[model samples]
Target: MLALFAVSLLWAFSFGLIKGELTGIPPALVAFIRLGFCFILFMPLALMAKKYRPNLRLVLLGSIQFGVMYLAYIASYQYLPGYLVAVFTIFTPLYVMLFDALLTKRFNAVLLLPVLLSILATAIIVFKMPDSGQVLTGFAILQLANLAFAFGQVAYKHYSVTLDSPHKVNMASMYLGAMLLTALAALPQTIGSDIVISQRQWAVLVYLGLIASGLGFFLWNLGARQVSAPLLAIMNNAYVPLAVLLALTLFNENADITRLAVGGGLIIISLYWAQQITQRLENKVD
Candidate 1:
């Protein structure tokens, strides 16, 4: 579990890598290139887990995740700083929370109160960043990315439960879905002037494809098999806060922590409280 948490951190902190790597490439090309590597990596794993019938539905869900969600994330970061994008990642749990309520057919408005607070805190935090007035554009791009990611998440939360054994599942197929869909979506940009990427960009492309998308998805899926949803959500969402500090320390970017830190802290507190309440209710039902 701790290792899984570290994996999430690795995924989170790699914003520096993306920022470094994307400098030489276009967003679609970066996404397609990365997914291409991920497809290759997932091939062996999918073969090894051949006996377990692939869940086509989940694969489609993963496709939406990559094609729509991840594509938007990469493109947004091209305009926005990586930190802003990371900050939006924190809101993933909000999608999970809403999905849980809708799927369970329960109205836990109290629990969602925290979720709302968290969103508000995150907004204030981003607003407070010291970006020499360059953040407005970044902020807009990031908001679009967030909307894209949310759409993907909504699809996942709705469809993921259809898989009979998500706990100990064939994660390879899920990634394969993403890999194929992202490739298809990315095909349009592969032609024309945007197709040619330099060597430095290629290095970055390989890293994003192999490490971030390929290995990262592999690790995350395997980790999910060993952990619970809430645990995974929390681990993944930790990136939100760590990202601010990562930006400041890593890229020497100036981000005002005063508002975001305090607001985000409160939001985390509310999120945890909501988690506890929801968990207790679930325990009672179970």
Candidate 2:
């Protein structure tokens, strides 16, 4: 849980960085560079580990989680406004719970309460109705991204428990998979394009690639492995309000302080409620 919170805080600045610094860059190119950094950071460690080999499952999981999710998410911006994208992302918590239930073949109705609360809280902070006539294409694309991300978290949490190797070893295979997918997606975008990156953009990309995408994801998955599905679901949205708050303060973006306070308070309550429910469940099992 601490890992999750830490990653949330770490990721809070990413929104501002991307929106502020990396605006003209192609999304696939950005994703490729980021995942490339992840691969570079983890692959060597994996190779040095004794008796290490690639895990196909982790590769596939990474492809879906990081690769597909990034592509789909970036593509959605073509059809939807940024605010709509944020609004649509609030559904991710529900998708997380749904995927977990489906994969585990156990649905605890009690856990749904916190998940719903988290969604409601996030919606309060970010939700805005679309003024455009048709946004179904973007909505579908964003949902696909959400589903991929949600499934990846649930699947990795369930699958990582059976692994005997260190998580970083497996992360190498995952990043490799992501790198391949994003590289393929970015190929056409970069070919014959006079893509000039400023020094500042390069620095931002490096930070996003190394710290946010690499370390942040590693910690988030580590935290996911330690928590229940419901808690994991709730934690999915925990960063939304924080990101908004950071944008308001640091980036000079205007936001409703009252909404932030109210929604943020509800998010905290949902987290507390989830912790209590999780403890009770563990006690029952014990």
Candidate 3:
């Protein structure tokens, strides 16, 4: 849970960071920097750690999971506002939960109701993402990109847990993904403003690439192996309050929202209720 919190913040800030860094560098180029740094750092580390290298099938799987999927998400922010991108990203857990239930043959439609509500509340809270002027076209392109990213996430949920070790798979996936992103970035830019960064911005980039992404994956995959998919799925909802609350203080310091408080209370209560129900169901079936 602590891991999830830290990782979520890291992820939450990434949208803004990426947007800020997109001043003079190409979006693809900035993406390549992020992934490439991870890959460069991990390649030798993976070799040293039990000489880990992925097999062909695992490589292909990781390509979709880490490579194309990530590019799709990052590229979308180019077209849409960062907040809108994050809202769409909240759907990731819902999609993965549905697929995980089907794959594991453990459907829990009753308990998933709370999660559905969480998604609804989150969507409402983060509505009307800033357009920077362009409205429909930008939002539509981002949604399309998010859809592709969601499919990739489903692909990841199927394979992420099967890996023998998260560290092994984590590094291996990044190595291959970095290579792919670097190649893709070589093409001429077709859209989005170029991303440029100052020295301070570079620090954020390192934290994002290393701590947020690299260590985040390591911890998430580790926890995912130990917990139920549904249990872990709920953590996805936590990101909303976490991001909103943090940004509220950091940006405007407007910590006076009666309705938001009520919604938050409802979400927390429902989450606990759903967990208890899920546990009861599991025990009954067991």
Candidate 4:
């Protein structure tokens, strides 16, 4: 849970960071650079670890989760506001629940209440909607990205449990997978565009890749292992309030503090309610 909270803070700043710093950079290029940096940062430790063993399936999963998802996620910024990207991510918890149930073949209808609450909370925070075709496209793209990320999280939790491997070693492979896929995706842009980066952009990419993507992802997933599936799903929305707050403070974006406070409180209540429901259901089964 601490891991989730930590990553939520770490990831919350990212929307503003990318919008403020990396907006001029091609989104695909930004993604590729970040993934490359992440892979490089983990490679040395992965190589030195005596127990490191390559898992092809995990590599594939990570590619979908981080690599392809990053492509869609970063590109959406070209069409949509960063805050909306964060807002659309409210659906991720629902996707997480759905994917978990589909994979494990155990459906929990009660989880939907929390999922709906999460979305409603986000809607409260975002009182107005953009009725634009481009914004709609961005939302669609963001949802695809959300679904891919959620699938990866649930899949990794299920797969990583039996492994004795360290998270670093596993992450090394995952980041490498992201690097490869993003590299391929970025090739045309790399070849065609004479991309140049200011030192600030480079620094931001490094921070995002190393700190946010690298440590944040590892810790978030590690925390997932310690909690129930429903709880883990709820934690996915922990970033919503933090991101909104950061956007307001850092970007001077217009945000209603009252809405943020109320929405955030509702989100917490939803989590507690979901946990209680989960516990009662388990006790009934037992």
Query: Against the true structure, whose lDDT is highest?
Result: 2
Question: Which portions of model 1 miss their true places by more than 4 Å?
Answer: 1-4, 52-54, 77-91, 128-169, 219-236, 260-264
TM-score of each prediction: 0.75, 0.97, 0.79, 0.94
Let me know the TM-score candidate 1 reaches against the reference structure: 0.75
**Model 4 segments more than 4 A misplaced:** none
- Write the number of the candidate with greater TM-score, choosing between 2 and 3: 2
Instruction: Give per-residue lDDT, candidate 4, residue 36.
Output: 89
Tens digit per residue, CA lDDT, model 4, 193-220: 7788999888998999899988888898
Ten contiguous residues with the weakest lDDT in model 2: 126-135
State the lDDT at 235 in candidate 2.
89
lDDT for predicted candidate 3 compared with the true structure: 0.60
Pairs in steric clash, model 4: none
Candidate 3 on 131-223: residue-level lDDT in tens? Answer: 476645655655454444444444455666566655555555644754575457645673454544688767866876676666665555445
Error at 66, model 3, angstroms: 3.3
Ranking under lDDT, best-scoring first? Answer: 2, 4, 1, 3
User: For each candidate, what is the lDDT?
Assistant: 0.61, 0.91, 0.60, 0.84
- RMSD to the hidden true structure, all candidates: 4.2, 1.2, 3.8, 1.6
- Give per-residue CA lDDT, model 1, range 65-105, as digits (tens): 66566776766664655555655556676665555455557
Off by over 4 Å in 2: none
Q: Give every collision pair in model 1.
A: 34-209
Best by TM-score, which number?
2
